[model samples]
Target: MIGPAALTLLLGLWGVTREHSMWRDEAATWEAAHRALPELAHMLDRIDVVHGVYYLFMHGVFAVLGDSLIALRLPSVLAMAGAAAATAATARRLAGSRAGVAAGTAFALMPSTQHYAQEGRSYALVVAAVAVATLILVTLVDGRGKPGVPARRWAGYAAGMLAAALLNWFSLLALPAHAAAVFMAHRRGATRLLTRWPMAAAAVVAGALPLILASRSQAQQVAWIRPLTWSTALAPLLLLTVGLLCADLLKRLPATPPTPRALSAVSLGLPLLAFPLLALLLLSLIKPLYIDRYVLYTNLGLGLLIGAAASALVRSWRPLVTLALAAFAALLPLQLDLRTPQSRVDDVLAPAEVVARTSRPGDGVLFIPSLRRDTAEVSPGSFTALDDLALAQSPSASGTLQGKETAPQHIRRAMLGKHRILVVADVDGHPGSARDTVKRRVLVEHFTRCADTEVRGRRVQSYERGTSCTAPPLRS
Candidate 1:
């Protein structure tokens, strides 16, 4: 049991946790957690309502430990370690010991698992909680030939559900899957357990109502998500395939159906991986709410499927499975790639470095639509002398995940006062809205573009009041 978790911790710690740069979401967490507690509470009122619990938890970590890359993300690393251990215990309870060990090992090697294992956000913790809850549920339901469960185990299951739900509100979506797990775990006559379990789950849901209601107003956070597409839709299909494979394999023995425990494990894991994803996909067709990471906890079941399948495969050709696992564990190239800063879509490092070096004293930096203020996330001190021209209130004071926007009149005044202005914007080779429209109109109408450089996710341009386009461009 400990071997699997130890190996998992070693893998998670090697390069990724300490080496990779914080991506946008993690940067968001960094910004949220670094604020004063009162300000953080206010910020949660308007934005990141769904993540309030996690942000608050990290806030404590920041308060006590002080902020650094390691300090920020160490919680997630530990969470993933817990997730791996719980997965092993769940697999052990359901299948045999080999399957338990295999599941934990597979989880550690999974790319998605590794990605969140070091992430600063709450996803790793969410997965860990969900997995632990499943393990307890399996233990609750796997009492074959026994009539009633102990009162303490029932309390544990309810508490687990509450923690899982609070960790990430979307995790409540897994309740139906857990309902299926309960039903499948006791395929015969266990009406009492089934009845009692859902009542406990309901209590958990009831406990989570305040968060659900609060976060409903923050739905705009996901407004950028378009309805589901075929490409994004392949994932659930693949998971269902795994579930089907498990089902197919379970039916193979001619002399006998699988024992109650084997049946329970397969039943719990299959739905655990497949059902919620299918629901999310279907719901996404209606609302476009599907992000692979949103339901990241589902990977718990994926690891189980892989382990169970691998165990089945290993029985036939033990050498093949052993070689594959060994190769995966030793694959230095893949691990290194995962650890690189470039692994993220918009690594803040390059753009931030360019701005730090190029920006001079008394420069005015403006973020179009005002969200790119986060470009300073890694090198905040680099911009300490520069004015953030469009911000009305700081992210902390405004109670916003992103900083508040200044009125157009105020922004125009700020632009007019600055001799040199730097715009770090999402130019994406496109025009702007009323806010950007105001900034662009003021800058181009009054100043000359001294220089403009494109960075990964943004455009950085410097404008001067009287310079000409034909004039020699200043150093970038």
Candidate 2:
């Protein structure tokens, strides 16, 4: 457990800063965490209430660490490490020490685990909480019918489940998987678990009910998610395929005499790996919420299945060593790429640097679609000297991301008044709203594009009011 945790921590710390870059999501975290407590609470009341607890926790992190990139991501690294340790402990309890070591090592090497371990988000912490809860569940099942099972174990299990669900409501998907595990254990003679598990699950539901209800009203925040397509399922399908293969391999191994409390790896691992993912996929048929990151904790089950297969081969050391090396070599490229800035959708700092270089004092700034205002909010130093022509209120004050923008006519009037305007926009120029369409019309009709440059996933343009428009309207 210690070895795997150390390895995960070292991998996370290797390129923790991602070359000093942040993407839009992390920028959101930074903006929210730096706000005053009252401002954060106000923002949550209107938007992103799903992340209210995470934001408050990060608020404390930034307050103590003074808001460096390392500070932003370190908690995730530590949480992932803790998750690896807990996963190892769970595997050891089910199988053996060899299985535990193999499981933890496999977890640290998984691309999904490595990716989220360095991110500034709640997913890793949720994974850790779920891992701990699953471990406690295993312990409770093992102790069933023994003299006086400790109540604190149930309390810890409830607390862990509550923590995971509060961090992300989708984590409730874990409950059905836990139920399946408990049922399987009950069939294996742990009959008392059938009664107690429901009590713990009910407590978790009671604790998480408020957050689930509050976040539902803010459903529009996830309105951008499109219905799941074939491409969306490809990665998860591949992972499930691998986990199934490992489970099959475990079945073919020579059966050792079962212990009194022993549960088959397939019972726990298959439910953990398959249940949450299947639930989300089925739900996505009605609404598009099946993002891979939302159920990242499912990877722990994959690790356990793979570890159990590796444990079966441990008697023949050469096969285990060869397989481990082959797996590492296969994953090396992805591990390296995860540390680069391009791994994310957009590099927020790249456009901020362009803004710093191109803007002059008193120059007006505009963000097409307005949400691009996140770039300015994240790196305010680059944008402080320029005037924001469309903003009617600040994000913190407005209790919304990107702030509130005035009416289309008011935005057009403001743009017409500025001699020079700096525009930070998306490269593809997604047709956003009627208001953004008006910004493009005014720019094309009245301003000449003097400079244009494209960064990672954004375009930075400079325009000046002139006698005739010299360049075409922004691309759409």
TM-scores for the candidates? 0.91, 0.96
Worst 10 residues of 1 by lDDT: 253-262
Which run of 10 residues does model 2 get worst, by summed lDDT? 255-264
lDDT of 2 by residue, 250-306 (tens): 878863224545366678888899999989998998999999999999988998898
Clashes of 1: 1
What overall lDDT goes with each candidate model? 0.76, 0.88
- Give the lDDT of residue 282 in candidate 1: 86
lDDT of 1 at 5: 82
lDDT of 2: 0.88
Each model's backbone clash number: 1, 0
